[model samples]
Target: MDRKKAAILALSLLTIISTDTVAPLVKQISASYPQVSSTMVKLTITLPSLLMIFFGLIAGQLVKVISKKAILAIGLVLYSIGGIAAGWSESFPGHLILRGLVGAGTGLISPIITSLIADYYQGKERADMVGYTFAISHFAAVITPPLAAYLGAEDWRKAFIIFSIVPLVFLFTMIFLPGTARRVQSDAAEKRKAPIPTKAIQFALIALVMMIIFFIVITDLPYLIETKTGISPIVSAFGLSTCTLGATIAGLTFSQIYVRLKKWAIPTSLLACGLGFLLITFSGTSVLILGGLLCIGMGIGILISLIMLVTANSAGEADSTAAVALVNGGFSIGIFISPFFYANLPRIELGLPAVEFNFLLAGVLFAAAGVIALLVAISTNKQLNLPHR
Candidate 1:
């Protein structure tokens, strides 16, 4: 591939990395600002999702008015500024506001990733690219937490400096990403808008559930380990990193999985996560927790790729960006709401410990989702095989 395409793909990886830049530092930040609620601290990682939800939709529509490259370039600048400024804030509330700016930047850039790929590629190549995008994005996940943990170890504020990379990406994007989205826009508009398929929404809802489950593990992980196992936050960061490694493996092999399993791939991934979380519920050692996290990550990796593909394929060229934006918005909503949702779940009467009980509840729900996906796949297969009059 040429430098231009590589640059575009790199943007996809950057988006995921930027979102979690503060994740490893969440515990440190919360400790630094004891006056703030734990839920508010977690919002440092999730609050961006609120803007991402709004801007994702708005960005999709803006494709009609501005070039994707231009929006992307401007977003990169905002992301860099917000990420760096958050570190300088003396107040937690001030930091939260800066993170929102970072999220606004992400919202502008995120939806365009799929749209750009859709604009530039098609058919089997497109599918392959989608899988590769997930692989690379998960590969970033594999590296980011440990890196953030290391940086945060010195000072939580230093971790925010990682956002400086945004400027480099911005420079590459401005120079390499093509200027022809304008022409593509005209062509896309000429094509009649098709209704987004119902399957897209169904897949998105499942993705939303998967994201919520995934975030539950991440958002609670440091405190859960500290409170239950007396482990260091660094250990939880490594455990989370292990999950990303699992996701990286899944992402790299997803096309092959898709070829053999076809419609079964999504459910199979979900099942892996469900089983993983269940294992974590009973985990007696760090090893078991790491193993469970791996399963969850692997499943989430595949689900994300599958959902993006479904949304992009289900809509017309013109609507593909908006469709993808909507799906992404659903995932962002899940992230934003995860802390509160888990907080409100009725505690089980079982003898399980608090964190263990939460994992058990999440495990059962994820497993149920997998079962439903399987049934839906089978029913759809049968319907497809039936003869039409």
Candidate 2:
């Protein structure tokens, strides 16, 4: 890959990894924020993207006036700072604001990466990068929880400190990145901008909905394993790790999977995930729930990889940053809304330290998103009428 393309992939993966690294520290964070409710704590983790949804396009639109590399670097800086702040914060509101800053940085970096990658790579390479990015992100997801546990045990602050350093790694990547991919203020780019691909936007929306399912499985299901079934925190984290591990494997070959199956992959994976969720909801056995979670995790790996593939291809540009943004934006938005599903679940019983509902309603969302993904594919494929030859 070209330097610019490599930078885009590296930067995008960094943002993805950084966002989830805090998961293991949420409990520690809540302990310090004595006045913050659980909902607020959840927001501390989730609300940053609410800001991101509004401004994801701003950094890229400023491409003519600013360097894409600079914007990405700045975003990484914000992410690292916010992470550090979360670790150090004593007040609920302060952590909330810093997390938003972190989200903004994540929001800013992805579109530029999308735009740069589409601009620099093409066809299978572009698709492959999308999958690889997912794989790397999943790799982060796998490492972060265990790492966070170690760091948090040492000092919850260390978890955030660990992420503060991750962004610095990308600075070297920026140095190696080529700079030709900037929008360059050409009249041609301006004109072509008017007819943004509808299918790309469609894929983006699909990402948002599909990801509701992903989060439901990842974020919500573990609570169910812990509260509903009484699994220990350490065991729960390991079980959740199953999802990340699956994502890593699936993403490594996402382009090939996309070419072989296209949109069909989403529904197929969802079906598997849905079955797992159902099994967990009813079963008390740790082994059974773990197996179900494994299926859910592996299926989601395939599902999300497919979503990224569809978005990248639908845009039809090697440097289609907007396309990537659209999907990421959808993803961010889905994350923001996912907490509602957990509202109806069971609670930590009297004198018992635990969470309620096991995020069962969240599973309902996963099942629903799966159904919608299938419908979207069937309907849009017919509408687009892609080439028969």
Candidate 3:
């Protein structure tokens, strides 16, 4: 509500842009480094994701030892350096390592974004702030991919330069974020005793599933368009931007949606995801694919916000950061695994050129996940409504 909180939220959104910065450059990087296989090129996108899987949890634990602000400062430094150096690196191996550093840096900051909000805000304000963060993330996505594509069109290295601005974001955060670090003392008995809630665990699992479903589309969309439709990266950028637009809409309207749907919010989101994937899988042209991707983005937009809200609300304040870290880590794991799943799986004999069998499978999986989420929502609703004997 105040300048400080607003600053933290804005700075936190900067971190969101980092996650997808390299996506548009994937094709160019692959072309630039022909020595590596396509799969290895894809790893450039997922490698940082893999590090986030471990570092997210490590960050949670590290918060007990160091200030979240300090960790974030360090992360921004790594992120800026990695992003800047990546543009200059000639060796493929060196580029990969820089990518990993960027991921590690992101891992440190990602968990704290929501946790800081949870720590600072409460009740309706907390929920609204959470939605705002998702909206900010989507808005950043809308800007970032297209810009990366434009720059990458000239030279893939140009895309990495965008990451250098992150240090400016760090400066703003240091100046504006309030100094309120929680340091747990060495006395075991006096330590914070909050337990991770069951709902948080469930949300973490849901985050994992949703992330896999969401990122498969993200990681594959550009390549799929280039390989199938013979479109340029700019066109692919537009399609992805359309998807982010859908997410932006969802993020902006999340409060109304959450108020209306309540406990069914996540299930409704999951259904949207399923529908989106279906549209994408069966789409005949890039326009139709954009439509499908929009649907997918809307689902993810709502799902991600709701999951963060649930995870943050479930934990007591003492454990909020750790709870967030666990969920982030789960999402990271999903991100790490998505590329591999698509790469290694044998193509289906679906007679459809340019249509991946994996997309079809992904559609089915999303639909099934939606159904399961719906059933679980109903069951949980019933349990909550039951009278005491």
Candidate 4:
């Protein structure tokens, strides 16, 4: 691979490094911040997603004014700063501030990556690269979660602090690499060349809806399972690890399937995701929950791979980065809203209360994503005239 491809490859590691520190250190963070409620701590976890919501869109415009390479470099540096600052946060507000900055870093990298890939390659090669990129993300996912748990056991501070080094890796790779996205001639030239497609807009909406449901399930369901089923931390982490395994397998496989039928990707993934949620809502035992997670993770894997694929196809060259940024915004929105839904769910078995409604609410969103997917299907088949279903 060339220098630009090398930089693109490094983007996968950034995802792993960013979230790996959070889960294992949750207990320590809860204990350290005496003034913060568990719910408030959840907010801190959701903070990046919240920032992603706005920044994904803002990042698109930002790329217009500055080089994508510069945005990524600055974002990664800030991300390190946020991670280091949060490691020593003495107050809830301080942690929140650091998390918001970390979110900014996240907002910059992923979309820039997708856009960069679109800029660099085309035809079958583009499809293959995107698939491999997603596979790397899953590989990182598998390693990061467990390693985080181990490191947190030894020293949680090191967990967050260690990730600060990842940006250095991304920055180094980017510096050594050549820029892939060529500068357009005039201010209006790039926009005219890469005008937003109707398909891209619809793809983004579907991406947003699917992510909203995925985060809702992942964020709220784990705690519910722990408290309701009396599962130990090790067991809980292992089970969630299974989700990563499923996601990994699917990420690699879907890239091939998507290449054969580019237009149908979003709707197909959405239907699968909706079914996964139904499985989760009704899942009563630990085994059932694990199965549901597997299905859900598989769906998510497919969705991520396809969304980027669709973005590349629809966006003009210059605007492609912005389109990817918009998809990132959708991702952030999902995380941001999952908690809001998580909070409102009826409490589980409070001695006086009935069964928990968290998964049930999550089920509704998952199923709703399916509805959105079907609508997208109708619009796609009719507007694009490609028989998306």
Candidate 5:
């Protein structure tokens, strides 16, 4: 409710705005550019993700030399310009170039937002802020894609107009976020700094896998719904939105969930995702598919927040930004690789339809991962001599 929290939430709203808004417009954009390959056209959605990994690490280092607010401002400006201009581009290459700029901007912005939360809040309050950040981001995700699909119905370029909202977030950042000085560390201070925790690295890897699974819903569900049920793509888009709606619900309630689940939260979330995917695998109707996606979204939403919180807490303040960036970079990598990874699976050999096989594989993977996480938690609790919750 405070200006600082508001500013943070406003920035959170932009995190998914850059890439997701363009997703529904991909087919239209490809159609408009008859000369370009479908692979290149698809990059309109994934290119930003590839660039995010590169620039996200750069951002982690930038925080050491510049104020986070200043970095954020620069990123916002790039995102606004690149995202808006891409819509107007006449050439396919030009559009891809602009999208890369948007990705760079997002890369810089994403790590800083989580690092800022770590810098500004602590303990349960920090956990709550992380939850709100996920909640706000998913809420934006739920709203933006449908709006973009509607706008791009006639002209795909118009969907880029969604990025025009970046200026409003920029204004909030400039007005409400208090500026901090560069994080200059002396040789002695640097020596005293602990190495990034192994747990943080492990969690970053978990984040990578989680995004790979979660993006199955994002990148594949619309196609699945349309092909399976012969529904309009707009309805497919809405079906996708239900996934984010579920995530939004999870984000809003994560604090209480964490309070009750503690370390058990990770496995519980993975199990929820597995069950959701299983529902999608077996369900025959569009409405049932949407319900499955909602469940998947809730599980992924909580899983990501838990990863961010645990990773942040694992490192010293000086190293937190870099640690957070690693996890975010993992997320971007997962996003970039998901479509190809799923598309190339040996589904043909298995004698199943692509969409059905994808969901079935996802369900099995999530369930296996959940059991692994439960074992890890049990082992960790034993090592710490802690009571099982």
Candidate 6:
């Protein structure tokens, strides 16, 4: 790959690596702080997401006034510092605070990466670059879990060390990433205030729902495997890796899939996810669970790339960063709320174990969503075929 693409791809890894890298350590971190509520412990995983929502939007505006590279560098510095410091924190509150810093940093970084891709590449090239972006990030996801599991095997603190790589990425950004001038808007254009495209908002909402469904695997699967199969947490972590493995494959193939599937792509991806969740619900063994996760991964992989492409294309250059940030922020919100949303559901009234029930619920929702998407796709196709008045 060329230097610019390589630098962007490396930056991609930083967006997701911190969360996935620390996921395996969640249970262990909870064990260390017995007085803390389970929800609080899980916040260690989700808190960054909460911060990302606000920071991402802030980043959208920042890019208008500052160079994208400068914004990225600042975020990297904060992310590296916060993520590494959180590992050594003795107090749970302090740890969460640091995690917030990490999230804020991520929020700042996330939109810039997508906006950069939208800025630099176009048409099929842009679509392919988006795919490659997700592919590289998911590829990192595939590697980090097992490594984090191993590193945190004896001490959960060690896993945070993964964040240290941010410094190298920062150096790469400075050395390789070309600087773009700040966006200069005319006074008339500024006063005119072009509205964000409605389609962008629609896609962002879709992204929100998709993320809620997708994160069920990430936030709940380890506990599911541990409780149902009595497997080592390492195995559970591996299950997480399998999801990303499938995602990586999907990312690598997204261009071909999009070309062929066209309007049907979203529905097909949703159905695949629904099927995967059903497999996880019924499967009795770890192998089956991993298989299910892989399927889920593939579905989400295509779905996310599709959303990014459509949302970017819907907006003008001036609105690109904010539009993309809206979708990414939706993702963070869904992820942040997932555990609480699933946990609060009346699983007891439904007469099912929590984890299994969460998976089953997600399966049913995705299946229903798939049906809806199919209908919408058919309607849209029919509309396009209608003669113009």
Better of 4 and 6 by TM-score: 6
**Clashes (N, CA, C under 3 Å) per candidate:** 0, 11, 0, 1, 0, 0
Candidate 2 per-residue lDDT, tens place, 1-389, comes to 56665665566556555556766666667677767766667786568766677557667465546777777777777877886777677677777888888888878876776566555556677667767877877777788777777878857777777665546656766688865664343465653464446876786687777665456554544455555645556556676666677678778877676667665776767777777777677677777777776777677777776666556556543345566676777888877776664554467554533232344444566677679878888887543211211
Clashing pairs in 5: none
Best by TM-score: 6
* RMSD from true fold, candidate 6: 3.3
Across 44-83, the per-residue lDDT of candidate 6 in tens digits comes to 8888998998998898888767778999998999898998
Model 1 C-alpha lDDT per residue in residues 142-164, reported as the tens digit of each score = 78778888887978888777777
Model 5 lDDT at residue 331: 92
Compose the digit string of candidate 5's lDDT tens values, residues 1-389. 77888889999998886777777777788899999976567788888988988888888777767778888988998899998999999999999999999999999999898888877787778888889999999899899989999998999888888888898889978999878623334563672355767887787787777777667776666556655654445457687678888888999888888888877888888988998899877777767677788888899988888788777777754657778888888898888887888877765567667887898889999999999989999888532211211
lDDT for 27 in candidate 4 is 62
RMSD of 5: 3.1
What lDDT does each candidate get?
Answer: 0.77, 0.66, 0.76, 0.67, 0.81, 0.83
1 against 4, candidate with superior lDDT: 1
Name the regions of candidate 3 deviating beyond 4 angstroms: 181-195, 227-235, 346-348, 353-355, 375-389
**Which runs of model 1 end up more than 4 angstroms from their true locations?**
182-197, 227-235, 376-389
| lDDT: worst 10-residue window of model 4 | 380-389
lDDT of 4 by residue, 94-167 (tens): 87898888888877777777777776777667777777788777767666666666767766666675675665
lDDT of 3 by residue, 1-389 (tens): 67667766666666556667777787788889888988788888888888887788888787777788888888888888887797789999998899888888888888888878776777767777777878887788788888888887788888777886787888888888867643334563434466667877887787777677678777887655644653444456687777888888898888778877776776777787888788776665766677788888888888787778778877753647778888887888788788776667776677854336667778888888789978888877442211111
TM-score of model 2 vs. true structure: 0.84
